[model samples]
Target: MPDPAYRPAAPGDGRRCPRCGHRVSRYNDARHCSPCAQALRREADSCPRVHESTWAEPEVQSAIAARDFGALCRLVRGHAQLRQEDLAELSGLSQAFLSMLEQGNRRLTNIDKIIDLVNGLGVPAQLAARMFGRPG
Candidate 1:
């Protein structure tokens, strides 16, 4: 018996995935099989490190220098290519709170919360020191 998950390709209907030798539905633009695509997504999601160059960007530096937590959070989210949900998961902040903060509807004034955000996002220690007005 054939695999239930496997769909035999009809002409122009599907193609074999290059990565897994499995049928890729025509509707799936990525071309990888579902399992392969899911695995790729998992791998990408597993690493959320912000690139070193992201810290050097003028906007990021400005946000840090200004101590604008909201703007800094937004910049980090963008630079790290993370959704608010992902960032919330990492920072232990609620998604709604992060959205509000990003929109300037809320402020992150509490020192502990600031530390949590900095630590959760893995902001470089030197930069965190600068942000906190401590000599790095």
Candidate 2:
């Protein structure tokens, strides 16, 4: 593969992927082309941080095995790839509130709040049920 660091044939022609050297349109000025960037994102997403394997950690797994929803909530957030601030933006909750909820200092007793968390974290319905129980 060509060196991504190689500059465009002409100085203003376009840019190349720093990692793979693939060329992309010059207008965007992105470091890596879209494809390469997507590939890198996929690679990063596959890491253990937010991947399924995170649920297998001893503490998280124990919480699942014991059906301890509060612990599960905390564990899930702790293992999530997005920071608490980012998650708060996605869930429309305050960071302090999310932290309190995750730490069990504040309860997640509201159905709406539970739904927001589940949607924001992409947690499956079955898993949410484990934490909040079924809605009447």
Candidate 3:
């Protein structure tokens, strides 16, 4: 992978993958390219703040930052109108883990895993923000 830091940064340029901050294929528009930005918006239910919040939160300073999956679950549950038990059964994530996530006691270890849950609930990545945070 090329070094994004070494790559030049400029206005209206594709910088890096905000989630992982990796240099995107197109650097002229920044990783928050149209596609990534749309993804972020969807992940937050068209609510950019939730997606934006992680960047400001203590432990979640970046799109790639660790998240409070528990809070995320509550959000998801509300968004999907599904009970935690139903989600647990559908995603095969243990009920305890689901409960932990609802309480913000744990965070997602893998985005793919969260994707599974999201898919099962018919939630869009826009709500998941393929890019977790905007790269500053």
**The candidate that achieves the highest TM-score relative to the unseen native structure:** 1
Off by over 4 Å in 1: 1-47, 134-136
Off by over 4 Å in 3: 1-67, 130-136
Ranking by lDDT: 1, 2, 3
Per-residue lDDT of 1-136 in model 1, one digit per residue for the tens? Answer: 3334555567776588878897777666565778997898898879666667778878888788778878988998898788888888878889999999999999998898888888888778878788989432
Residue 101 C-alpha lDDT in model 2? 66
Among these predictions, the greatest lDDT belongs to 1
Cα shift from native, residue 83, model 3 (Å): 1.9
**Sequence-dependent TM-score of model 3:** 0.41
lDDT of 3 by residue, 1-136 (tens): 4335545666566566667675555544344545665687687663212233333333322222234556655655554556777678667688888988677677777878776765554434554463355533
TM-score of each: 0.62, 0.47, 0.41
Model 1: lDDT equals 0.80
| Worst 10-residue lDDT window, candidate 2 | 127-136
| TM-score for candidate 2, residues paired by index | 0.47
Q: Score candidate 1 by TM-score against the native.
A: 0.62
